[model samples]
Target: DVKVTQSSRYLVKRTGEKVFLECVQDMDHENMFWYRQDPGLGLRLIYFSYDVKMKEKGDIPEGYSVSREKKERFSLILESASTNQTSMYLCASTSGTATANTGELFFGEGSRLTVL
Candidate 1:
Protein backbone atom coordinates (compact mmCIF):
# COMPACT_ATOMS: atom_id res chain seq x y z
CA ASP A 1 0.00 0.00 0.00
CA VAL A 2 1.10 3.52 -0.73
CA LYS A 3 1.34 5.59 2.40
CA VAL A 4 2.01 9.31 2.60
CA THR A 5 3.04 10.74 5.94
CA GLN A 6 3.09 14.40 6.94
CA SER A 7 5.25 15.87 9.66
CA SER A 8 2.55 17.87 11.38
CA ARG A 9 -1.21 17.71 11.59
CA TYR A 10 -1.50 21.31 12.78
CA LEU A 11 0.79 24.29 13.11
CA VAL A 12 0.52 27.79 14.51
CA LYS A 13 2.95 30.53 13.64
CA ARG A 14 3.25 34.27 13.52
CA THR A 15 3.48 36.32 10.40
CA GLY A 16 6.80 36.49 8.55
CA GLU A 17 8.06 33.26 10.09
CA LYS A 18 9.57 30.56 7.98
CA VAL A 19 7.68 27.27 7.85
CA PHE A 20 8.60 23.84 6.63
CA LEU A 21 6.17 21.03 5.87
CA GLU A 22 7.60 17.62 5.25
CA CYS A 23 6.09 14.66 3.45
CA VAL A 24 7.31 11.12 3.02
CA GLN A 25 5.90 8.31 0.97
CA ASP A 26 6.45 4.59 1.50
CA MET A 27 6.07 3.74 -2.17
CA ASP A 28 8.76 4.57 -4.68
CA HIS A 29 6.40 6.62 -6.77
CA GLU A 30 7.83 8.81 -9.49
CA ASN A 31 5.45 11.66 -8.91
CA MET A 32 4.75 13.68 -5.77
CA PHE A 33 2.66 16.79 -5.31
CA TRP A 34 1.82 19.54 -2.83
CA TYR A 35 -1.53 21.26 -2.74
CA ARG A 36 -3.29 23.82 -0.59
CA GLN A 37 -7.01 23.59 0.13
CA ASP A 38 -9.07 26.68 0.71
CA PRO A 39 -12.77 27.00 1.45
CA GLY A 40 -13.76 27.90 -2.10
CA LEU A 41 -10.56 27.71 -4.06
CA GLY A 42 -10.69 23.94 -3.85
CA LEU A 43 -7.37 22.11 -4.15
CA ARG A 44 -4.78 24.30 -5.77
CA LEU A 45 -1.53 22.71 -6.75
CA ILE A 46 1.50 24.38 -5.22
CA TYR A 47 4.33 22.29 -6.53
CA PHE A 48 5.24 18.88 -7.84
CA SER A 49 8.31 16.78 -8.38
CA TYR A 50 8.41 14.08 -10.96
CA ASP A 51 11.94 12.90 -10.26
CA VAL A 52 14.59 13.45 -7.63
CA LYS A 53 16.02 16.94 -7.89
CA MET A 54 13.47 17.90 -10.54
CA LYS A 55 10.50 20.10 -9.65
CA GLU A 56 7.80 22.07 -11.39
CA LYS A 57 5.91 25.04 -10.08
CA GLY A 58 2.17 24.63 -9.96
CA ASP A 59 -0.63 27.16 -10.39
CA ILE A 60 -0.12 28.84 -7.03
CA PRO A 61 3.59 28.79 -6.41
CA GLU A 62 4.14 32.41 -5.55
CA GLY A 63 4.42 31.86 -1.79
CA TYR A 64 5.54 28.24 -1.87
CA SER A 65 8.44 26.10 -2.97
CA VAL A 66 9.19 22.39 -3.02
CA SER A 67 12.11 20.03 -2.72
CA ARG A 68 12.49 16.43 -3.73
CA GLU A 69 15.85 15.32 -2.45
CA LYS A 70 14.91 11.65 -2.38
CA LYS A 71 12.57 9.39 -4.28
CA GLU A 72 10.21 8.99 -1.33
CA ARG A 73 10.45 12.44 0.23
CA PHE A 74 9.04 15.79 -0.80
CA SER A 75 9.19 18.98 1.22
CA LEU A 76 7.16 22.19 1.02
CA ILE A 77 8.66 25.46 2.17
CA LEU A 78 6.84 28.63 3.00
CA GLU A 79 9.46 31.36 2.72
CA SER A 80 7.56 33.87 4.80
CA ALA A 81 4.39 32.69 6.40
CA SER A 82 1.44 35.06 6.20
CA THR A 83 -2.15 35.06 7.35
CA ASN A 84 -3.36 34.74 3.79
CA GLN A 85 -1.33 31.58 3.54
CA THR A 86 -3.22 29.80 6.25
CA SER A 87 -4.81 26.70 4.77
CA MET A 88 -4.82 22.93 4.75
CA TYR A 89 -1.83 21.57 2.90
CA LEU A 90 -1.93 18.15 1.35
CA CYS A 91 0.71 15.76 0.08
CA ALA A 92 0.01 13.14 -2.54
CA SER A 93 1.84 10.48 -4.50
CA THR A 94 1.10 8.38 -7.55
CA SER A 95 2.82 5.32 -8.92
CA GLY A 96 2.49 6.40 -12.57
CA THR A 97 2.24 2.74 -13.51
CA ALA A 98 -0.28 1.07 -15.78
CA THR A 99 -2.10 -0.90 -13.11
CA ALA A 100 -2.27 1.99 -10.73
CA ASN A 101 -2.86 4.51 -13.48
CA THR A 102 -6.44 5.17 -12.59
CA GLY A 103 -5.59 8.86 -12.19
CA GLU A 104 -6.01 8.50 -8.47
CA LEU A 105 -3.88 10.13 -5.82
CA PHE A 106 -2.99 8.65 -2.45
CA PHE A 107 -2.96 11.59 -0.12
CA GLY A 108 -1.90 12.29 3.43
CA GLU A 109 -4.29 13.47 6.11
CA GLY A 110 -3.18 17.09 5.68
CA SER A 111 -1.29 19.78 7.57
CA ARG A 112 -3.34 22.71 8.66
CA LEU A 113 -1.43 25.90 9.27
CA THR A 114 -2.66 28.98 11.04
CA VAL A 115 -0.79 32.26 10.85
CA LEU A 116 -1.65 35.10 13.15
Candidate 2:
Protein backbone atom coordinates (compact mmCIF):
# COMPACT_ATOMS: atom_id res chain seq x y z
CA ASP A 1 0.00 0.00 0.00
CA VAL A 2 1.15 3.53 -0.80
CA LYS A 3 1.22 5.73 2.26
CA VAL A 4 2.02 9.41 2.10
CA THR A 5 2.86 11.02 5.43
CA GLN A 6 2.93 14.70 6.13
CA SER A 7 4.97 16.12 9.01
CA SER A 8 2.35 18.60 10.08
CA ARG A 9 -1.40 18.47 9.77
CA TYR A 10 -1.76 22.19 10.50
CA LEU A 11 0.49 25.20 10.68
CA VAL A 12 0.21 28.83 11.67
CA LYS A 13 2.73 31.37 10.50
CA ARG A 14 3.07 35.09 10.25
CA THR A 15 3.69 37.08 7.12
CA GLY A 16 7.29 37.14 5.90
CA GLU A 17 8.17 33.98 7.79
CA LYS A 18 9.73 31.07 6.06
CA VAL A 19 7.75 27.84 6.28
CA PHE A 20 8.61 24.29 5.45
CA LEU A 21 6.23 21.42 4.74
CA GLU A 22 7.58 17.91 4.57
CA CYS A 23 6.14 14.81 2.97
CA VAL A 24 7.31 11.26 2.77
CA GLN A 25 5.99 8.37 0.73
CA ASP A 26 6.55 4.74 1.61
CA MET A 27 5.84 3.21 -1.80
CA ASP A 28 9.14 4.30 -3.36
CA HIS A 29 7.26 5.97 -6.18
CA GLU A 30 9.29 8.02 -8.60
CA ASN A 31 6.95 10.96 -8.85
CA MET A 32 5.87 13.26 -6.01
CA PHE A 33 3.83 16.43 -6.22
CA TRP A 34 2.75 19.42 -4.14
CA TYR A 35 -0.55 21.18 -4.62
CA ARG A 36 -2.51 23.93 -2.97
CA GLN A 37 -6.27 23.96 -2.71
CA ASP A 38 -8.19 27.20 -2.70
CA PRO A 39 -11.85 28.11 -2.70
CA GLY A 40 -12.20 29.55 -6.19
CA LEU A 41 -8.94 28.53 -7.80
CA GLY A 42 -9.46 24.84 -7.13
CA LEU A 43 -6.42 22.65 -6.68
CA ARG A 44 -3.28 24.06 -8.30
CA LEU A 45 -0.07 22.20 -8.65
CA ILE A 46 2.86 23.90 -7.01
CA TYR A 47 5.81 21.66 -7.76
CA PHE A 48 6.76 18.10 -8.61
CA SER A 49 9.80 15.93 -8.55
CA TYR A 50 10.04 12.90 -10.78
CA ASP A 51 13.36 11.67 -9.44
CA VAL A 52 15.94 12.44 -6.85
CA LYS A 53 17.46 15.88 -7.46
CA MET A 54 15.20 16.53 -10.45
CA LYS A 55 12.26 18.87 -10.05
CA GLU A 56 9.72 20.59 -12.26
CA LYS A 57 7.76 23.70 -11.43
CA GLY A 58 4.02 23.38 -11.73
CA ASP A 59 1.40 25.97 -12.70
CA ILE A 60 1.61 27.99 -9.49
CA PRO A 61 5.24 28.06 -8.45
CA GLU A 62 5.77 31.73 -7.89
CA GLY A 63 6.09 31.53 -4.11
CA TYR A 64 6.96 27.89 -3.69
CA SER A 65 10.02 25.70 -4.04
CA VAL A 66 10.67 21.99 -3.67
CA SER A 67 13.52 19.68 -2.76
CA ARG A 68 13.79 16.01 -3.53
CA GLU A 69 16.97 14.88 -1.84
CA LYS A 70 15.75 11.30 -1.49
CA LYS A 71 13.45 9.03 -3.42
CA GLU A 72 10.81 8.87 -0.72
CA ARG A 73 10.87 12.39 0.58
CA PHE A 74 9.75 15.67 -1.02
CA SER A 75 9.81 19.01 0.74
CA LEU A 76 7.98 22.21 -0.09
CA ILE A 77 9.24 25.59 1.08
CA LEU A 78 7.52 28.89 1.33
CA GLU A 79 10.16 31.58 0.97
CA SER A 80 8.06 34.26 2.56
CA ALA A 81 4.75 33.21 3.88
CA SER A 82 1.85 35.56 3.26
CA THR A 83 -1.80 35.71 4.13
CA ASN A 84 -2.75 35.12 0.52
CA GLN A 85 -0.80 31.89 0.59
CA THR A 86 -2.97 30.35 3.27
CA SER A 87 -4.56 27.20 1.96
CA MET A 88 -4.72 23.45 2.21
CA TYR A 89 -1.58 21.85 0.84
CA LEU A 90 -1.55 18.33 -0.44
CA CYS A 91 1.19 15.84 -1.20
CA ALA A 92 0.81 13.03 -3.68
CA SER A 93 2.91 10.33 -5.27
CA THR A 94 2.60 8.01 -8.22
CA SER A 95 4.63 5.46 -10.07
CA GLY A 96 6.58 6.92 -12.96
CA THR A 97 6.94 3.79 -15.04
CA ALA A 98 4.52 3.70 -17.94
CA THR A 99 3.73 0.06 -17.42
CA ALA A 100 3.03 0.46 -13.70
CA ASN A 101 1.36 3.83 -13.92
CA THR A 102 -2.38 3.84 -13.58
CA GLY A 103 -2.80 7.60 -13.61
CA GLU A 104 -3.88 7.27 -10.00
CA LEU A 105 -2.49 9.53 -7.32
CA PHE A 106 -2.08 8.47 -3.71
CA PHE A 107 -2.47 11.53 -1.55
CA GLY A 108 -1.71 12.50 2.00
CA GLU A 109 -4.30 13.85 4.41
CA GLY A 110 -3.13 17.41 3.67
CA SER A 111 -1.62 20.22 5.72
CA ARG A 112 -3.69 23.30 6.31
CA LEU A 113 -1.55 26.42 6.68
CA THR A 114 -2.77 29.73 8.00
CA VAL A 115 -0.67 32.82 7.44
CA LEU A 116 -1.68 35.84 9.44
Q: Compare the candidates by TM-score and give the number of the best one.
A: 2
Report the C-alpha lDDT of model 1 over 21-114, residue by residue, as the tens digit: 9999998898899999999889999999888999999999998888889999999999999999999999999877346355678899999999
For all predicted structures, in order, the TM-scores are: 0.93, 0.93
Record all residue pairs in model 1 with backbone atoms less than 3 Å apart, i.e. clashing.
none
lDDT of 2 by residue, 1-116 (tens): 65999999999999999999999999989999999999998889999988999999999999889999999999999999999999999999988655554578999999999999
Give residue 96's lDDT in candidate 2 (0 to 100). 68
Q: Provide the lDDT at 103 for model 2.
A: 74
lDDT of each: 0.92, 0.94
TM-score result, candidate 1: 0.93
Indicate which candidate wins on lDDT: 2
Stretches off by above 4 angstroms in model 1 are 97-102
